[model samples]
Target: MESLSTKSQLDMARNVHDMGSINKMREAIASGDETVLQEAAQQFEAIFVQMMLKSMRKAQDALADENSPFNSQQVKFYRDMHDQQLATDLTSGGGLGLADVIVKQLGQTEDSYTPASVIRSDGDLSSLNRNRVYNVAEAQDIALSSQSIRSPSAQKD
Candidate 1:
């Protein structure tokens, strides 16, 4: 039973690690926050493009000799960095337009919204309820009082 539980826990951990970014993107899209959703979509597109680049590199024949001075671990690391930067630049500069399509399909266009700065003034808690705002001291006092009320020792005293 213990071994089964441990195996299940390991599987859960691996699934969480693999789906972390995807979960974040889903959350952003579901949050109704246009800016965050758009940014997440763009980043996802960038990652997709980077994966494509890596695959393409793997498919290509190595033109450089193994004994060449330019062929080293550092060179490979720098090449990966270059590929990452290229992916970022391509996405930012409207590379494949995948992000744009995603944003459009999600119906989060810039035309349908106003900036928050223009809508709300400073010190605006009008939308928030009273229960949402409380001091830490007040919370601690409430907790202490609740514990005292619930304790059998307090009742006996």
Candidate 2:
């Protein structure tokens, strides 16, 4: 494997989204190519970490200043680049251990393994907890009830 620059590595990581690139990664793992397997696993892990970071950022949108000059497209681009680099660095530093798990599982099998059955659960909300499924009214009621339960002395402060 030739040494690739950060940009090249990022490009390769982006290519992992393509079916052909995924198939090639599977083939490399099946062949027990340690270098390729490690690279692919790390890239996959970085993607996962990046997704997590994106989700966290999205969740923080409510707290963001809407009128800030730093909220422009250029800032967003830089933030995304920062996130990508952070994901890569985290994965290289033994991240959430996803890469290790992926490498271990792939290394254990001589051939690529496929599930015998596929179960689809699209649009299913039955698994959600009551709190997660609560309507706005119900949530407000809960908040009010909780506030009512607070001690008068504590509330005064």
Candidate 3:
């Protein structure tokens, strides 16, 4: 079973999707303060976008460096995923553009990209709670194995 820490991180990442809705939910559950909810929502959205951009940049840099062992094939996967992530960001209430750098580095065109399938396909939050956001921290064989890109490259961080 995945640990609670991992689950919590995944929840945070998934929650990054609907900042407004999340704030409303939090406010409704707390005391129905729309202003507090709005502020909280903005904060969450900002933090989420910041984190995503940072992660995307780091991943793109790591992948692009030939010595990093990310390799061309792995870079391709990460690139595609990053592109999808960028598309999703366009629909997000908070506008961020970190994915643009990653997409450019990957040599992807705007037309070739697609939006986030997970968010688009999934329904409401309570009904659509996702599994853990997979990360290298949880991988047991990263150092033990030869694969440099051990986890799914499609993942942001």
Best TM-score goes to which candidate? Answer: 2
Residue range 62-115, candidate 2, lDDT tens digits: 688989887777888888878977887788767888988988887775466655
Residue pairs with backbone atoms closer than 3 Å in model 1 (clashes) = none
Report residue 126 deviation for candidate 2 (angstroms). 30
TM-scores for candidates 1 onward, in order: 0.45, 0.51, 0.23
Report lDDT (Cα) of residue 138, candidate 2. Answer: 88
**What lDDT is reached at residue 96 by model 3?**
53
Model 3, which residues run further than 4 Å from truth? 1-33, 64-157
**C-alpha displacement of 20 in model 3, angstroms?**
23
lDDT of 3 by residue, 74-134 (tens): 8767765665455444424445543333335444457776668844856644522432323
Q: What is the C-alpha lDDT of each candidate?
A: 0.64, 0.71, 0.50
User: Against the hidden true structure, what lDDT does model 2 obtain?
Assistant: 0.71
* Candidate number with greatest lDDT: 2
lDDT score, candidate 3, position 142:
62
Which candidate model has the greater TM-score, 2 or 3?
Answer: 2
> Which pairs of residues collide in candidate 2?
none
